[model samples]
Target: MTTYASGKIQTRWATLDDLPALKTLINRSIDALQVGFLSPEQIIASHAVMGLDTQLVEDGSYLVAEYDGVLAGCGGWSKRATLYGGDHSRDLRDPLLLDPERDPARIRAMYTDPDFTRKGIGRLLLQQCEQAAADNGFKTAELMATLSGEPLYIASGYHPLERVEAIGNGANVPLIRMQKILQP
Candidate 1:
């Protein structure tokens, strides 16, 4: 569909046809930005073996931003009976979402083309993820946000549940587990 942008752009629900391009864009972005944070092996494993293309295919939330029909950015989630923290007390305002058995949808992959960086594409993809989670009956959404993406997630309404050091490439990388309660 047509989208408003400085140039020709499109925003639409990702289909099977978009998977290959989306996967390539996500992998390229991660490799460019996450070299110090994620191991090369980890990056390849996550993107090649499992990512938005493979993981979010079965009843999971997935979206794409296209510039002149080229895949520019994407974000998505997958439902889980449990999450990292555990069930919110049915509260949107005061939620205690869990990581395990917490009725959450996991927001996993989000990426934008370097050429499209600083544009609103990332924000749009993130908001689309939230809406998809809510529509899928999730009371909340959660993600292990990267350092660069954390601020954007926070600005978009996600709150930090905990911050921990993740061992990657035999180095400690800070990871923030965050949640965003969705309105029913």
Candidate 2:
């Protein structure tokens, strides 16, 4: 897990009430970064209902970054067994690419509010995910990163396996599958 040099960031478990703010963070991140990587319509529609927090509840793990007591970003992690759910995963083919039964943590729903970008909020949140996985007895954490999130994951010691392009709104949008292997 990569730790941030900055100390202004704080992370905590998210509650049900944080759903709305988390939604905004997800959508804003898409708007700021995905627009260029995807069509305007594809970006908007894919991120709209997909950002709803309820979709992530089954992941059984979530974390939020805060700046001055306000949410700056949120993400989720769970046991490695391809056990994941979200509006976005409903259509996933072979979603169980990773053995949820073997891997203790799968990271998903990562997003940092644009206003808080470059300030280490996303990095902190990712590190927090790694730590959470370790605390839960997992030796690795994985994520499928959006174009905008690739840099942060790369800088945080994540390695890319392959880039996959999917047909969304008739456009091919690329996503990277990454993982951070941790020592148990």
Candidate 3:
């Protein structure tokens, strides 16, 4: 837990019980922040491809940031092959376990509430995820970042690897793939 200008920010592993609030927070954050870069349809479509991945909660890797008792942000890192997707992904694939010795830990589903933007909540959650990943023996991290989220990832030392179109709801949404070397 940390204190910021907004209030007390607390982070903890998300549980299945956190799903309802997490989903609401994520969708709200995405809709509010991505409007400038994405169309309404595109944003709605993205939900099908990008939303809460319950598996993260099951793995105890998903985290939620609360500001004075309110959901402010959420994110997590995965030790599996799935890079990005939500519960509603069309092309369902088994989450292949990754070899932490060689594979990059995946940073997944990062979202910050609009009211808490720039208040350091996202950064705090990200730091926690990175530290946890490193502690698990991962040397590097990767993620598919929304345009609105690219800045935060870059500011945190992630470098762009490629720009790709994620097919969501029959629409092509531009997303950037980024990677970062985790420091010991």
Candidate 4:
């Protein structure tokens, strides 16, 4: 738990009961923040292409942050091979468990409500994810960051690896792949 100007923030492992709230928070965050970086078609398509991966919840890797009793943020790290993408992604069919000794733990699906921006919710969630990943023997962390999210990840110690133009619903969406070595 933590407090900021926004209010008291609490985090917990996201459960099946939290799916609706998580979905709403994620879509709202993307809609509010992705403008100017992603086209409307791309945003709409990306929502379908990148909304809610149940695998994270099932694997106990997903978390939700709440501010004043409202869901403020959501994000997680994955032990599986999938790097990015939501439920509609074709790549989700094969969720091979990752070898943490070699493959970096994936920082996945981070979203914060517009009202809660810069209130420490994202940073807190990220810290928890990183610690959890390291505890699982991951030596590094990586994420496919949306343009709006790159700054946060960069500030949190991730460095850009490459620029990727991902295809979503026939639109090309630009994303940055970022990585960081976990502290032992």
Please provide TM-scores, in order, for all candidate models, with all chains considered together: 0.71, 0.79, 0.93, 0.92
lDDT string for model 2 (1-184, tens) is 1223347777767767777777777778778867666677767555532354453444446777888777788787765344323555555523343443366467777787878877877777777778777777777777777777788888888899888765555556667888888655
Candidate 2 segments whose C-alpha is farther than 4 A from its true place: 1-6, 39-42, 48-60, 80-85, 93-101
RMSD of model 1 against the true structure: 7.5
Measured on C-alpha atoms, candidate 4 has an lDDT of 0.86
lDDT value for model 3: 0.88
Which stretches in model 3 have alpha-carbon errors above 4 Å?
A: 1-7, 90-93
TM-score of 1: 0.71
lDDT of 1 by residue, 1-184 (tens): 4233434555776667777787678667866766666666655433332235343544435677887766788777666432222111122112234343356777766788766777778887777777767776778888877766788899988999999764443455566889888777
Ranking by lDDT: 3, 4, 2, 1
lDDT of 3 at 158: 97
Residue 184 CA error for candidate 3 (Å)? 1.5
Each candidate: what lDDT? 0.64, 0.67, 0.88, 0.86
Task: Extract clashing residue pairs from model 1.
Answer: 82-100, 82-101, 82-102, 83-99, 83-100, 84-99, 85-98, 85-99, 86-98, 86-99
Model 2 clashing residue pairs (backbone): 79-104, 80-100, 80-103, 80-104, 81-99, 81-100, 81-101, 82-100
Ranking of models by TM-score:
3, 4, 2, 1
